[model samples]
Target chain A: MNTKAFEKLNYTLSLLSAANGDKHHGCIINSLHQVTASYPAKFTVTVNKDHETYQAIKASGSFSVTLLAADCPEGLIDCFGYRSGRVKDKFAEYAVKTDGMGNPYLMEHMVARISCKVVDSLDIGSYMLLVGEVTESEVLGDGPVLTLQEFTNRGKTTPPAATVYRTMAGNGFRCTVCGYIYEGESLPADYVCPICRAPASKFVKQD
Target chain B: MNTKAFEKLNYTLSLLSAANGDKHHGCIINSLHQVTASYPAKFTVTVNKDHETYQAIKASGSFSVTLLAADCPEGLIDCFGYRSGRVKDKFAEYAVKTDGMGNPYLMEHMVARISCKVVDSLDIGSYMLLVGEVTESEVLGDGPVLTLQEFTNRGKTTPPAATVYRTMAGNGFRCTVCGYIYEGESLPADYVCPICRAPASKFVKQD
Candidate 1:
C-alpha cells in the first residue's frame, strides 16, 4: 500500500508502566503523545490488549512514563520492554522511585518521569487507547530524547507480527556493532557499514 | 494541581492541512504523533471541533502533514495558527506545491511532506481524534525538527484559555523583542536574557 511513506512521521520512544496492588508492569511504546497542553495536561498511549502492562494500567487507572535517554543501555530495554513484566520484578535490578500510587518510574538513563491518571479510554480493534491526565511530572535531566527514527537508525527493528508499522521497503542485514541496519534483497560477503565502516561479519539478517 | 510539573512531557510541532474541493485549510498543531510503526504506519491527531481545518479533514477524508523546520518564521505561525482558516486562504501567500492527492503541502521551512487517508476516528469531548494511514511521504530537508520546548524557549506562549498545556510555574515578564518569557512572581529591574541578553527594560508583564 506504498506504506514506506509512513516513515516520515517521527515519535519519541518511552516506557509506560503501571501497578495494581502488588502487580506492576511496563512495556515499550512509541505511541505516547500529548493531547491537551494546558493545566491538567493530557496524554494518550496505545497498547496491545493482551499485554500484562495493559492489564495493570486498566486495573490501576494510572501509569508512569519514563522518557529514555539517547544512550540508554540495551539491558534496560530488554528488561522493561522485550521481557514480560508478569514473570519477574522489573524494578528489582534498577534504581527507581515510587509515585503516590506506588507505580515505579525509572531514575536511570531517563530524561523525565511522569505520572498520570486515566480519565478516558477507547477500544480500537486489537488495542486500547488510554487518555490520561498527568498528575505529577518532573524533568530528570537534559535531552535530546531518543526518537523512533534514531532507534531504527541504530538498527533496532520492530517485528512486523507485532505491529501495523511500516519501514523502508525490503529487508536485509543490520550491522549489530553500530546499529546501522542495511536493507536489501541479500547481504554481500564483504559489505561494511557506510557510517561505522564495520565489516559484513558484524551484520545480522533481519528476521 | 502543581501543573508546572507537566512541563516534563515535551512534543514536536507541525502543520496539519487538508483540502476540501476548492477550499483548503491548515492549522498549527502540536498533537500529531505516530500510533503504530508498521504496514500502513498509523498516526493520530487531535483537533478542536470548531476549527475549519477539522471540518475539511473530515469532509475530504485525507490530509497533508508538513513537519516544520526549527527556524520556522513567526509569520508562518501567525498565519496558520493565530488566524482562522475560514477567514482567509493561507497558502495564497506561502510557497507550496501539490502532492499525489492534489493536496498542497508547504515547500518552504519544512522538513518533510506526508499525505494520509483517514482510517478511523473517535469523538473526544471538545476534540476529534483522527487516525490516518500515511499514503505517501518524502523528506523535504535536513532538520532539527522543532520541539515544543524549543518553541517556548524561542519565546512563544500558549494562550491560557486554550488547550490543557503546561508551562513554567508562576507569573513574570516577557521580553517582547525576543519572545523570551521570564517566569517568577515579579520582574527584576536588572534582568537580562541568558540567551539573547536583552535587558529588563524590554520586558512586559504576563497576562
Candidate 2:
C-alpha cells in the first residue's frame, strides 16, 4: 500500500471542543464530515482517544466543532495542534463562547460553528468515531474553509510565529518542558504541566 | 441554523464501490475520511441506505474507494451520481478492475484507490456509517484531488455532455423515464429501470 497517497487527499481542518463541567479543551482535527443532510442533520468527528478533548466529549456527551477559515492565524493552529491541552488552558487566550449545548467554541477566524450531541460512537482502536446530531449551527464568516494541504503550503512559505508568553504579575509557575505557565499564589504539590505532563519538579517560578 | 453555511464547507469527491457475489455497484460520496493513522489504517464512509451501492457493501463486507481527480470528466460523474445502479449497470461503459478483496474499482481519472474490509458499521436512521480497515491501496496519479466545490463550479461553466446510448444489434430495452438502455434477448417480466425505478411496462423496445 502506498501510504503517501493518503497525503494527497484533501480534508478541511476543524477545531473540536468539549467541556466536562468546568474543564474545557479543544484540538485541531481534519476528519469532521456531515454524514446526513436530513432535517436535524448529522455529522461525524474522528478524534484520537488520547486527546484531552476526546475525554471531555466522552464525559460531557456533546461537542462543538468550529470550521477554520483560510485566514486563521498560524498562532491559533500552533496553540491547538502542537501543544497538549492537559498541560495548558487552550481557550484561555481566546474569546471563547459556549454554544447552545454549553460546549466551548472559538469566536475568531472561523467559517462556521456547529453544536452537536453524541448520538453514537464507534471505537476504531486508537481513534473514536463520534456521530453528532446537529443541535445548533451558525455561519460565522464568508471566508473559504481551510484545507490541510493549504495549511501545510502556508507553513512552508511563512516563518514560524514567535511564542508569546502571557505577562504575569507576581507568582507564576512555568513548565520547563513546554513553557506552559500556571498562575496562582503557589504551585500545587500535585501540579502537573498540562501541555508537557511534567511534574511540579520541572517547573520554575517566573522572575 | 443557517443551512447555507454547510454548503461552503469543502469535501473531496470519492467513488465508493462494492460487489456482492456477481452484483456490483458504485456511487459518488463526499464523506470518506481516514479515521486513524495507525499501521492498519481505518477509514469511514457514510452511505445512504436507499442506495444500491450501500446494499452491495452491506452484503460484501468490503468496498473499494477511488478518490476522483480534478481532471475527471463530467460524464463519469453524471453516470455514477445522477443515476441509480439498481436499474442500470453504472460500470458497463467504464474499465473496471477488482481489488485484492474482490471489490470493483474504476481505472480512470482517479488519484488513488483503496480497498477496505468492513470491520464495523453504525446505522444512523437513513444513513449507515461503515468503518473499513485498509487492505490495499495504490496511488494512481499525481493530479490534484477534486473537491465537491470544484465539481459544482465546473458544472456551471461547461455545457452538459450529450447522453450517448450504447448501440445494440439484438433485442434491447430502453427506459422511458431515465433513458437507460438494457441489452438483452428479452426484457424480464420483473425487470425494472435501475436508474429511474420505472417498471418493465415503461420500457420501449429499441428499433
Q: Who wins the DockQ comparison?
A: 1
Quality of candidate 2 docking, DockQ: 0.24
lDDT of 1 at A133: 77
lDDT of 1 by residue, B173-200 (tens): 7553334567787877889765346678
Model 2 CA deviation exceeding 4 Å by range? A155-195, A198-207, B155-195, B198-207
Q: DockQ scores for all the models shown? A: 0.25, 0.24
Instruction: Tell me the tens digit of each residue's lDDT in model 2 across B133-155.
Output: 88888899888898877877765
Query: What's the CA error at residue B73 for candidate 2, in Å?
Result: 0.3
> Native-contact fraction for each model?
0.33, 0.48
Give the range of the ten consecutive residues with the poorest summed lDDT in model 1 chain A: A159-168
Q: What is the C-alpha RMSD of each candidate to the true structure, in Å?
A: 10.0, 11.2
Lowest lDDT sum, 10 consecutive residues, model 2 chain A, at A157-166
